[model samples]
Target: MKKFIIAPSVLSANYMNLKNDLTQCLENDINWIHYDVMDYDFVPNLTFGSKILQDITSQIKMNIDIHFMVKVKTKNFTDFFVEYIKANPQMMTMHIESMNAKETKLFIDLCKKNNIKASLAVSPQTPIKKIIKYLPIIDNILVMTVEPGFGGQSFIEHAAGKIGLLRKIIDQNNYKTTIEVDGGINSETSKIVKDYGVDIIVAGSYLFGQKDFAQRAKKLAGGN
Candidate 1:
């Protein structure tokens, strides 16, 4: 099994004091930062682009995990995929709901060629079977606990079952793919997510809303 990790989402961070928040998270021993890349076509909201990602990466030593929610057009995705991989990120994820199986495999191959871990992301309504075939090659599986558009949403309880099933498939095949759960993750919901076999927890509002960022990060990581 992979080591547990708590990734604080930058989408919820105070943009005016972004570096300070990231520093505080690191002070708490939290080394993974989750970036949500949204293109208005795939998701209703628009968020960080390469400029913002570049800016953040330039200042931080922590591992970066990008969640891409954009149009599934092959050419466009390939271009964006190349750009994100150039950042030499720890992981880059694409929505299984957005692309066809062939595109998903191609994206994974591209990431591998660039030495970046490729992850498959699924929305709450997407069936687990849609992503199972890619699990053997993917480094991670991002199970969205809420819709992909925005942050500060409630946890969709059924997402737990989806994660459990994916875990079973990974275990049965003896694959090393890590299961990551995102959206609506706070202290209490994270506990439920752990019970469902999530290896990485992505928390946005729950983490950034608090004043004690370090302590909040520690608690989310299951520390004392």
Candidate 2:
């Protein structure tokens, strides 16, 4: 079995003491940080951009996973993509629901050219069929467990089915795509996601809301 990744979503970390919280996560042996990038147009919210990501990247040794929840619009989208590539995250994912097939391929190729592992994400309502063709090129697939844009929404129970279907498609194609689950991933939801062959579990409030982060990390990483 693949060692499941317990990636704490930085969106839920206290922004006032963000660096310290990040350092705490590192000290607790949690090595992956999930960055949820949202643009108000695409997801009804605005979030950190390249500058903040650069600051965090400079400060930590942990792997950074950038989840782009923005629609591809204007030349600015390409500019931001360049900035994200420069930030050099371990993985950079964009939503398939936001772009056409050609654009998705272009961005994935762009990430590959920059040596970043490219990923494609889909919302709860998006069908696996939308991204299945891109599976051969994408290194990972993020299945949103809740509607995108927010941090603390409840996990859509049926999202597990999406992950399971994705797992099957990946296996059938013999592709080495890492399946990731985000949103509403507490200890209980973690089990369901893991059972569906999810490789990375992105937890936000469940990991950061508590004072005992170390224990929370352990529980999130421990699956049946």
Candidate 3:
């Protein structure tokens, strides 16, 4: 069987006891945590900055999957993420819609310089062709099943077709790039994406909203 990772998104985590929640994840054997960074300008909603990310990384031993939903400009890529880079996440993902080709390459190079895995994210409406050229170079690809800004939305059924196409391309090219899907990833949707070749599953409300986090996470991992 292929390896499947369940990365619980911190967006739906309990802020009052954030560390405790994260510790529970680690105890449950789920090591990767999906951290979403949203700038109000890029996604209409505002999320945490590098300082908070640094705080989380400093305390938790879990791998941080930083998804930057903010806009990236060529002039300010480094400046905007200097502190985030210091946090030293396991992987950093940026949206293809946020940057031009030059900026995208610059972001990937920046990740390489810092020894962080670079990944590109595509929104539900954006076609796979937009980032086809990047599949070989990037470490992973994030396919957002719902809109990027908020959580708790239903999974878009049409995104499955996109996942299938991406899987076909990756298999044909023999690329090592992994596919990650976010939003509305409950037991049912998890199975759908897993069949379509998703290696990583990002669950927000579905995981955090439940009392038994480990059980839900195991189900998302394709357990019976």
Candidate 4:
């Protein structure tokens, strides 16, 4: 069986004091720092950019998952990808929406050359078939329960159905791509999602905003 990874999202962390919040994840041995990169145009809200990622990447030992939420842009993303991969290779994923199908495939190919773990993300409103086209090229699949720009949004219950669909497809095709679910992954929901074939669950508010961040992180990591 594949491991169930708990990548805590920074979207729910207190922006005023990110270091301390990130420290919580490190202290608990959470392996991946799931960062959400959003542009104001793509998702209606903007998030901290590459500079912050550069700073944080230097401090953390765990592999980072840079989930780019912006619509795929080929030229603009080239240098950013080059730089981020230079800082920490083999763990970033640019969103499929950021580029067209051909461009997305090319982006994943670029990541392969640079040793980055490329991934594709899809919004709830977007049809699942759009993501299916790039399934063979990308390393992971991020199924967004809520809209991707900001945190605090509730997980769409129907999102679980997509997991079942992808799981079946993967099974039938013998695909190795990991299935990841982001947004509202608390202890209760994590169990529910895991049962539905969600291999990686990104928990932000569920971990960072808690009083016992360490314990919560452990519970999530242990899939309790």
Q: Which stretches of candidate 3 lie over 4 Å from their true place?
A: 73-75
Backbone clashes in candidate 4 total 4
In angstroms, give how far residue 224 of model 3 lies from its true place. Answer: 7.1
Give the alpha carbon lDDT tens digit for every residue of 1-224 in model 1. Answer: 33579888889999999988899888888899999999899999999887777777887898999999988655555776666665668999989878876777778988888888889899999888887777888899999999998889999999768888887888999999999999898878887888888899999998885877666676777732
110-150, model 4: which lDDT tens digit per residue?
78888788788877777788888677767888888887787
TM-scores for all predictions: 0.94, 0.96, 0.96, 0.90
Order of models, best lDDT first: 3, 2, 1, 4
Compute the lDDT of residue 45 as modeled in candidate 1. 96
| Strongest candidate by lDDT | 3
lDDT of 2 at 82: 76
lDDT of 3 by residue, 86-137 (tens): 8889999999999888789988999988999999999999999999999999
Residue clash pairs of candidate 3: none
Residue 113 in candidate 1, Cα distance off native in Å: 0.3
Give a tens-digit lDDT track for model 2, residues 1-224. 45788889989999999988898888877889999899998899998888898888887788999999988776644666877666779999999988877788788888888888899998999889888878888899999999999999999988768999988888997999999999999878888988898999999999885888888888777757
CA lDDT of 149 in candidate 1? Answer: 87
* Model 2 CA deviation exceeding 4 Å by range: none
Clash pairs, candidate 1, are none
